[model samples]
Target chain A: MASLLKKLGSFAAGATLLFAASAALAKPLTVGFAQTGAESAWRTANTNSMKSEAEKRGINLKFADGQGKQENQIRAVRTFVTQGVDAIVLAPIVETGWEPVLREAKRAKIPVVIMDRKVQTSDESLYACFIGSDFYKEGAMAAEWIAKNAGSRSKIVELQGTPGSAAANERRKAFADELAKNPALKIIDSQSGDFRRSGGKEVMEAFLKKHGKDIEIVYAHNDDMALGAIQAIEEAGLKPGKDILIVSIDAIKEGVQAVVDGKINAVVECNPLFGPKIYDTIAKIKAGEPVERSSYNVDIVIDSTNAAALIGQRQY
Target chain B: MSKSKSLSPVWWPLIGLAVLVAVNLALNPAFLNVTVLDGRLYGLPIDILNQGARGLVLALGMTLVIATGGVDLSVGSVMAAAGALAAVLLAEGHGLAVALTAGLGVGLLAGAANGLLVARFGIQPIVATLILMVVGRGAAQLMTNGEVVVIKNDAFAFVGNGTVFGFPFAPLLAIALFVAAQLFLRRTASGLFIEAVGDNETAARFAGLGAARVKGLVYVICGLCAGLAGLMAAANIRAADSYRMGENMELDAIFAVVVGGTALTGGRFLLLGSFIGALLLQTLTTTMYNLGVPPAVAPVPKAVLILVVCLLQSEHARRWAVSLVKGGKK
Candidate 1:
């Protein structure tokens, strides 16, 4: 009878400890994600990264694909608000018409996190903050590299992205700004590639035909165009990395591999995996900590040295 | 037909091509420079031919389809889907033949679906093909799992990037297909039937021509050509970019056919004229890049080219121009 009572008391104590441990673990935060549809590989990688990060952090992510439409995003935001989510993450397809919906979320008192794109609002208090990769800085970095590594009196051929696009405009202006500081640097020919491999190749071929030996370097806006120009340069009997120094942005797998192989000189990183940082921001905002109006993702430059080590982690 | 009428629309595209080439020459005297480097013919003109090959292939089927009183808006999607399918197959270590067949087969199936709806069920060609167009893009995304499928295959890459007699195999394939199509339409009675069906559907039905079947067959042909285009595109890059590949190609093909002087309402089609039209479009693109034209307004030149070609081919413009020439003589 005494042994039975002692055993029962010990079991009760263990059960009490288990209950306390269970109570100590906090419930996972519920976040609703309104993603711009999978329009490209970069976007797909982004979506995957978000999903995996959410799972790792134990955040319940409510994902909604906007299919690259503004109206779809609006509807999605409304639905997330209805679900009473703790936080909302939006990767808007465009930069306009987000005010009305954002005001609604603000009225609901749900903290909203903007990802990948900016929303122009007269009122800054409508959302938490905007987090995205900086296009201007990426281009500026490329230009800085060129100004230092490129030989004096280098005739640069630029493969611009689609004209009028934010990426294209910002990258072009920032690159031009850097080149303005150096009298030896000159962009001989600049044309839009529409951000495609084929477009890049056609434009590069034309530049090769027109400029010939006058072109000593290529500054393509992206890796795909850089790769295409490399093909054109090879066809023209000019070595890309040797005769003409090549520089491009975006450290996608193929581009990084080329860097490791010595075909391309440098690539600037635009990290797509924003899940951990996104939720971290949410946690901070929820805890009443002050946050910046805009959070910029770090764009790291990769050359032959770090490219081999970093190639395995490339998602695209 | 009178000599001017016979030469009217045909010679105009040739004239446009000559003018563009001349412009390129004046802009850069090296435009005509050709060298045999690494056993392959390398030049600006060869690049134009190779780049124009996709448009050339698409225009061929589009010409036939328009001749049969049909228009296909799904060629772009089909091209994307075919490329995606080939990339998937090649990346999985499948044989080149199997991958090509599967890619082309998807094109055939998509075309057949378009055909069955239009020919068998009497649906509008545009609507039927549009259904496939939207679906094919989505399917392409699904097939590649929304990722780029890059293949490292030499044999498959040769289909897109290889050269024959120092000329790109893509253009050779396009030329061979163009000639074969031209002969098939001119030599065979089936060609006349297709033209008849396009000219007068009801009258042709009374004349016992299978209008639906002809319309269906043309869409299938369009699909097949789009499929081949997709394969070459994937092979060229050794990867399938479903989102980007074959994008806006359908419009380009339609533009090529229209610039070639084919009446959209249906009837006689021109192969060589369409070929020249394709060449003109590609050359204009090359010229724009060399001139350092912004990509945003680059299409302005192409739009202007189309406008000029269409106006020059129009009956009223032709009459006015001829009268002006006569007035000058007087």
Candidate 2:
């Protein structure tokens, strides 16, 4: 009887110790983040959002800048896995060459949350969830606005993004697909601007010379290109918003201001603020709660009505 | 025979330009149409000149550098840094004069550095300029803090977008510079000196030519040209995008120099050929847009066209083609 009681007491002590150790491990909720380099305004804003949000939530964040290289990013992920953080966040620079490093993370039993750009892997189970903006939705939203504002038989010209880029291809595809529903509305001309202001201006100038006054609407894949088209339109002695309806995506600070000034008629937001959504998903993962495989931050369409109010609030 | 050969090479780019224009016209009847809008020219032709102005200016400097048997890979980066400095200055409420001078000064300094590396330190031109090519953009990014710095000054904008007597200022500036440079090269002994140094630097040095000084000066001139091009690019957009400004422009400038019949191995250079070459490239881009060619397949056609032009310019290729034709006839 005495030996049995001693055995029960030791088992109770071991159980208590295990529980205390787990509590200690779960308290800080450290997360490792591998970021794409601060190559642009949007990317910088995304980085700032991640940092500020982590501070607000009292979560420990380990940040690594990939400096626009996939090798550096893979090295960062390896470091994160070795560190044994509770979760890992990756803003992949490219889509492939991630399987091996990701497999290492999987072996370590760490959940990875992919942010802005996605990684391609046959094993979907490698990542816990993907948190990114829906580029297709942003394009569809812009096209929907065009369909509503543009009357029947409106001829449109599209300024595409960099060729073969996910954002460019998906945005162009979705816009075309959505606009296909309306038979009368047609894209008279489409060309890649390489997602640049100068390219946009040059291409728009050619489109104007080719199509002339027949072009009724201009849809640009991004704000920079739209801004360039605005210059081209003005140079042609035609009012941008008044003469040709302009629809653009990314709703950047300049894009929003252009909307308020009545240059761009519509801007579909591709929110770079992934902080709140990222943390919410992380919290769920920590609590053994079910989370969706992929979730996109909600984006809104900005026009004359809300552009004035929102222009001042744009961080990027 | 050498003079004839040299002269014939220059005509190839001009011929290429004519051919591209014809192709554009065939595809779009309005390809050559120019209309007066707000007293300024608005047409694909004008657009080509305006858009090609940056390349033209860069190619001018590149041609000189190439003539000296050196390449300025840093010109693109110099453009970025100079534009960033000017944009930041103008954004901070500085006058256009201050901004422009400072921008040009940055170019001169960057060129001097590259010249120092190549001439003073005896480093390879490719390796020396590659240092700036990598770091220059980073420095620009640092200045702009990774954001596109927008400028609102009309005077500054005028440098890029303004028109003089219905002609764009950028192209005019480019042409004026070209004419002046061409005159200076032709009228003085400096052109011969540059050619002598390029053909054989050791032999030129032995012959009492200031080879290093000539090399250093070309780099400075190239830097200045790139600086002007950078400012024009920034002014054109009314903003300074550090990341995107002057990206891959070195390759374009080199392409222009090569296409203009300037031998990459150095010694011989043609300014007019480069001018036409730059225009030819811009015409090709505009032609692609006018045709509404999908971006995915665009590069293939562009590559094929470039190959054809290059083949036509090559004596060996022309000879081979002639032989193949004769053999087929037999």
Candidate 3:
């Protein structure tokens, strides 16, 4: 009986040793996701996607909502670094003032992924991959559509997004670059709509009063502004799509629906639903697989031609 | 001539507003035309009118509250709560009259809670109202499950979107409220009592002015203004997005009141000045947009303009300017 007990004890010790070895080999990946506030439906959807995808992949996602404050976001990043997260994802509030914190992340040897918004850091090597719709390209696409639909002689009024945001900057740059291709396409007046419905409306109203019938096209950086501009246009006793062509980025459901209603002329899709792709990218990096530095492409445009068909599938 | 020499505080703000308008016109000649009025008056510009109307109403109530040596930061949040409640009830197919009545009732209840906390418990007005300011938005968000409730009732819509004699109903409603408040303050003993309590609370208390009761009444009045503002906002957009409803409105309202020549330190009230202040802010924003300035950059000019106005109004600034002029002459 003593000899039998000795044999069982040795067997138990061998099993424990093997378990320890496997445990040492398999390390859990800790991912920190700093999100912008759930200010809009698109932001909420983006957050949910990231969370659900993280859960499915068995990655620990440490989440923080910035509440539209840059300071809060910077603090969250510092907290993530102190907690020794394996990877980090940032959806920045603005384009500047991130180089120092990003350098800290680099020193900590954690891979960083820029989720939706891009930052204006001089160093490009600090992040692993940027996963977002190309805002500049999206803006140019909207402008191109307007140029094609409205012809070269149209007098355009631009409705810009949030002042210092990458989306706003890139969209404006790209739109201007495209419009520069057509000299006759004069941008009569431009103003910051602040990426809000009311901001868009107020600016549009002022634009209408200043330009009157000479105003041909209304180009907004986002759908909300476009929608707001449409209200202003209609309120002035002018047909929105017929009299003043409205084109905007962010093919959110409302924008697409507006296209269907013939209230807006065109909508350039800026897909906010980027969840599964982000999770897979993080997993690939963890497994020592080669991942592209910039992976996603902007969505296709939706206009009156395809508005009815695509409105049903539009999400945010 | 002697009475005219004793300049009313209202004239100061009015003069400042006129000078600012002149500056804007000088900077951009197209700013003064009525043709640009149509587009600017629709969404964002119109929303400003909406905000101004609401701010005027709240400031009118706040004027009373401040007169009683009290402050109410929760007016914006109360507006949100009222909007949320109204939106939810309306979404549930409740009668327009019923929903509006319930909204006002809720506002009164919220005000009463604030009043009771401050008056009955002897809590500081700022502290008492702060509690609601922080939690009221959360309550509003929770009420609508954080969803934007799109209202469809035309009767409810009329209050927000409809026009009266070619004038937007909201601005008109605000004007009506301002006139009523002006009448109340200028022609009533209750207004005098409020100002008396604010000027010297202990003295007013000693004089048997029922200072606590007067203080409580202002909070209720402030809540009612917020309720009305919420109704107008919900109607104009045909939706209630609690997330952004009346966001940072308290700051704007306080700024309007302060810029209107109502002392932040608390003493006198100016109904017309507050109204004009609201209009000034909206016009400034509209003008900035019209002048081809980027939206983000608008805040910079606005900040500078406000600083200039405030500095001009400061006694130290006024003295310095006068001395500089005298020195220049010498």
Error of 3 at A315 (Å): 2.8
Best by TM-score: 2
**Stronger candidate by lDDT (2 vs 3):** 2
Q: Give the interface RMSD of each candidate.
A: 1.6, 0.8, 4.2
Summarize candidate 3's per-residue lDDT along B1-330 as a digit string, tens digits.
Answer: 224335655665667668766875787675564423442333334545654666677777776676666788988888888888999999998999988997787678878888888877889988999999978888888888766677879899777767665557778888888898889778978778877877887898899989888878888888788777777767766677787777777777777777776776655777777777767766667667656666666788888777776665566676787778889999
Distance from true position, residue A36, model 2, in Å?
Answer: 1.7
Candidate 3: segments with Cα more than 4 A from true spot: A1-32, A55-62, A66-88, A92-110, A119-127, B1-5, B20-51, B121-127, B145-147, B290-297, B311-320, B323-327
For each candidate, what's the DockQ? 0.58, 0.72, 0.32
Model 3: per-residue Cα lDDT over A1-316, one tens digit each: 9999999999999999988986897866788999978777678778888888788877788999998899999999989989989999999888789888999999998888987767777889888888888888898898889778886447888998877777899999999999899887878888887787766876787777667789888899998888878877777889998888889998878789889999898999888778788877888887889888776654899998899999887655
lDDT of 1 by residue, B1-330 (tens): 235665757777888888888887887777878888899987788888888888999999898888888899999999999999988988888999999999899889988999999899999888988999899999999999987778788899888889988889999999999989889889998788888988998888899888888888988998999999999888876778888889989999988888888888998888888888888888888888766677777888878877888887787888888888889999
Candidate 2: segments with Cα more than 4 A from true spot: A1-26, B1-7
- Which is the winner by DockQ between candidate 1 and candidate 2? 2
Assign candidate 2 its CAPRI class.
Answer: medium
TM-score of chain A of each: 0.91, 0.90, 0.81
Q: Give all TM-scores, in the order shown.
A: 0.94, 0.94, 0.85
